[model samples]
Target: MRQRNFRVRSTVVAAVMVFSTVALAQPAAPLPATGNLQPETRAAQALPSLAPLVESVKSAVVNVEVVAKVSSSRGGMGDSPLDRFFGGGRGGSRENVRQGAGSGFIVDPKGLVLTNNHVVEDAVSISVKLDDGRSFPAEILGRDPLTDVAVIKLKGKVEGLPVVGLGDSDAVKVGDWVLAIGNPFGLASSVSLGILSAKARNIEAGPYDDFLQTDAAINPGNSGGPLFNMKGEVIGINTAIVGGGTGIGFSVPSNLVKALVPMLEKEGAVTRGYLGIQIQDLTADLGKALNLPVTEGAIINDVTSGSPSAKAGLKLDDVVVAIDGQKVGSANALTRVVALKRPGTVSTLTLYRNGNKQDLKVTLGTRPDIEGIGKRTPRETEESSKARVGVSLSDLDARTAQQAGFTRNEGGALITDVVPGSPAERADLAPGMLVVEANRKPIRSAEELAAAIKATPSGGTLLLRVLAPGANSRFLRALKVP
Candidate 1:
């Protein structure tokens, strides 16, 4: 199969897992004899011994039910001064709870199960129901929201349980037949068959979004179930499906979990190496401008000072071609490869610099909590208009300012909150930094900023160099605004 590295948005997972190369040659084997069935009946049998394989693994699969408790807030004036003094300004409170369900599979005999992080997050109570209808309380061991993977432990001993064998998802070809067995729509033990559809898709769900795409019929309740190959090995964990498609689905490769489970069991969390840099896909014009021979690998737009990349002497405008011999052609690929390394590990990066290949060794650092970035909904794009100078503005939040390495001081329209996923976030226009100018025009409030933006000609470019915290930093960005 094609060994491209790509991140997948949730639905994007179903699209990329289908890209596999042609099948390789292998010797065919003769069928084994059945003892009880008549000799003539062998010709009509669909599968020789699939029953034993299914029976062996079924005990490990489970149905997960979760309940989350939510508290409601109330605010109003108190009836009396004395009552207000005792109870404060807030009134009575009400408690509410929501129920959800999902699926999971036991990975160890001691009762450790694997499921999606989103499936059991914030749950106050979790229970796992086995195939024989026996249920046990489950406790979440740890979860990785960036990858949407979670591990949970169950009470009591359950020995001799058949564990699903993990297969190499990187080796699974597109035309290879696969099976998906899960509790779909709450239906017990639903089995669906399909072929690999694509691989290495960039759906934009998270940084490390690599997923296995399949045409297997997976639905709402199938979230953590296993996607098996013909040999009954778990190649992937069924995770998501396209909202409108019937047969399109996606799964987390079993290989990824194979690497994650041990770490979760030991540390109660997964630690990943980080190199602070902003990267972008290589475009034809950009490639030619950089004088690079090929439009492959990710281009470094900016590198944070004092970061691991900076310590390694990585520079802006450098193109990363590989990481420790692993080829990376996209930003998602770079993220995934970096995540595979430990925090203290030294990684060698092969980069294309001014049309020459050079190598640099970088001691990686642990990534900070990144669950909040990329969580905001994408902003709407507007028609571009040319206007006189003034800085564009948005609300000031701790997150916005921290990204720009600035302290939250002045409020009002913080620069660089516009949508459409561009370098505005890179322009260093962060929240808490007041927008002092637009097209060279002084802007005092939102009204002035709006007026300045409106004065620009429709379908033209606008520029604003704003003063932010620390040294007054200038901001530059281009957009079509209506």
Candidate 2:
């Protein structure tokens, strides 16, 4: 139950997709030099219907069906995109088989289809159905779980397949007309219309989560589908939707897809260049604390010993402003740039160190395993007899904070455990969560938290400012004392 709080721009449940951590190469066609793409031209006559466009592009869309062995206790194909919509995020004990379905589109004429990793990952058998009612078995060419993108080849494809045009996602702006084509709720090839609601959204799905959000009616079966612009170009791959929420859906930008497909097809895995540094977006508080004149870069929190940064003389608290002359606005930007390049690439980094600007040449190394980051550890079960609010609280220690992925400066009481069906669970508090503030007051220990709870009025709603490890930001929650 690892979840990153992307509470409306802030909630995402972190799904651990087991895959190779290596990064592959980007496509040969580089991104456009600028965000200034030519505006789409359209006819002046009012179009009567979208029938012509749908007829032209619908054949490129596809429905994907998969069957795999799963735990009988869990009852179905593991955590699927549709699982969020259908309420099925559980696994079982006995070995059993399950079925799942989603959508995709042909990217190459020779049957190169693109879909989500979650759709066909761990699948024992896969079948794809074209819009023209032709079904064929599909073979996975490669899968990059990190990006939620997978490349599958449709077997027995008699040449001459229709391909959806890939569009520039950077050129896509809010309020643009968009159409989502997919199988929603098992509805095959269903089309929904909406406007681009947002862009470059970090749904906290992954570090490179530059998603295109739309108000389209994307539902359970819509995962791995295509999001198209009015010009009938595929701009996004529909991936996620807010459960039970109206008009909120997200797609992986097609530009990322275009960049990833070539590598996935070639290497069958992706490799990321690692700098061996933990970083965060420079905050005004950090800027003031560090005596900095500006707060516009990524601040190095820690540099791993014996890693590339250590060898490159990179230090803790170094603010990385640019890499290879490209501006790095935040931690994610730096991460995206570094991760996309191959290992052994020497990159020049402009850094602000102790209020002094400097440049360092760093040869990027392979990023090691990050899958264990923020994983839960066995807590010391030293407990008090009394329980207030049915929550077990412990003093935040360095070990607890590190295991929870919190920075060294973060101080708080740790929610060690939550009793089932209790107020803590109702308030969405869980183990490994740092309770930084209670009732708007900073709490340093369990004793302080108890005092704060005692200070609250009886049956009053207790306001909590909580920071979960690996989360982008702190969030507010309220619990009514019972």
Candidate 3:
């Protein structure tokens, strides 16, 4: 019986081995041709693959290696904006040489590579490694921290370098497929697929916060990589990702990069056109208060003395509706449009003042260096008055004015208290703030502010030019009277 069982098992094993060999030898069946099928059926049968697109553009992507010396007293090598998001560095007694890696794409045949500014910032030595295994030392051409864009030139480059074409970021729509090729976590030639999750994302990274958000698995080493659209055109440059969140990444739009690249390459820095004015978005309440027909545009809060806007006659409460025929939908839009023009270029601004539209041609000026404002403690006031708009105000005395960073002769009404749930509190009015003007008229005392509020018609709006304590600039606020 045992001999019979052993022979049966051996036979079964031989049969199974023979069947596996035959199955392995057979080739995969070809998919049926869809040429003669119905349109819907054909679409269903043909699956889309990014293999061809990847093959075409992958050569343009390169790896960037940086070596820099960082102080031990500071956060060390990982103290950069990019490193803060990804995390690195350690404290020590002496300065240390840190080596980091990032990614970039060639934008010119002469080895011009566009990347994020933080990638090669403060680098003592830089190297670029092509996807085709070629490597060369590189030098920083220029870098702009405001836009987080940088241009680097590859040294000792011969010829035939693959270059990626820039695409119109304005044309990109949400949900459009995007490809991100980079060296994530030092893994070279890594490709990720996702859609343009959002556009014009303001992550507060810089003054120009317009970023294209995507879910394309952007990692630490992916900084400064190119984000490609379906046409293999670069639409954005991957700059940042969420700290510990998945499927959330930010890229600087290519249009912004395109605007900055020429200046960066030629001058090694960006010189933006400046109109010296503090502005804010025209909200619905502000529009209604100003009796504006439309609730869009940038409302001038304060005009810098002797600045371009001041010289052009722009004043507080003026609403800029358009710039050279381009609509200014928000304050940020106005800023971006103005900054794009070269200094000394005359640009026409269409604005609304007193419910009338007017155009002003003003030559742009170069942006000046920003001065810091020092903070001071709020001084006590003896006199106080209550207003119908639900706020207690006091006279802005000379000592308090100087402490608040204003001239000792400056006259205004200081807010001593704001009623909870009242219009004052709702408009973000808080104690220690000074009301400099009411309805475009200067206020010298708490009684003057109360008089201005009393003069406003029932259910009307009270426009206040307010100077917050310890602030360097003034802002305009519209409060509705009950």
Worst 10 residues of 2 by lDDT: 376-385
Task: Name model 1 segments beyond 4 Å from true.
Answer: 1-53, 70-95, 373-482
Best candidate, lDDT: 3
TM-score of each: 0.63, 0.65, 0.67
Can you write out model 2's per-residue Cα lDDT over 387-428, one digit (the tens) per residue? 335577877788877877877746788887665445577799
Instruction: Pick the TM-score winner.
Output: 3
* Clash counts for all predictions: 32, 16, 0
Ranking of all candidate structures by their lDDT, best first = 3, 2, 1
> lDDT tens digits, residues 1-482, model 3?
00001111101011112333456668889876667678999786685888999999999999998754444455533434433422334675544445677889999999899988777765545679999899877777877777778898887734899999999999999999999999876788999999999999877666668889999887777888999999999999998776544568889899999999998887777778999999999999999999999899999999999999999999889999999999999998898888888999999999999999999999899876452212111110101223245577888778877765665547788887775445577778888888989989999887899878767754578999998777779999897764
Instruction: Report the error of model 3 at residue 337, Å.
Output: 1.5
The stretch of ten residues in a row with the least summed lDDT in candidate 1 is: 377-386
Clashing pairs in 3: none
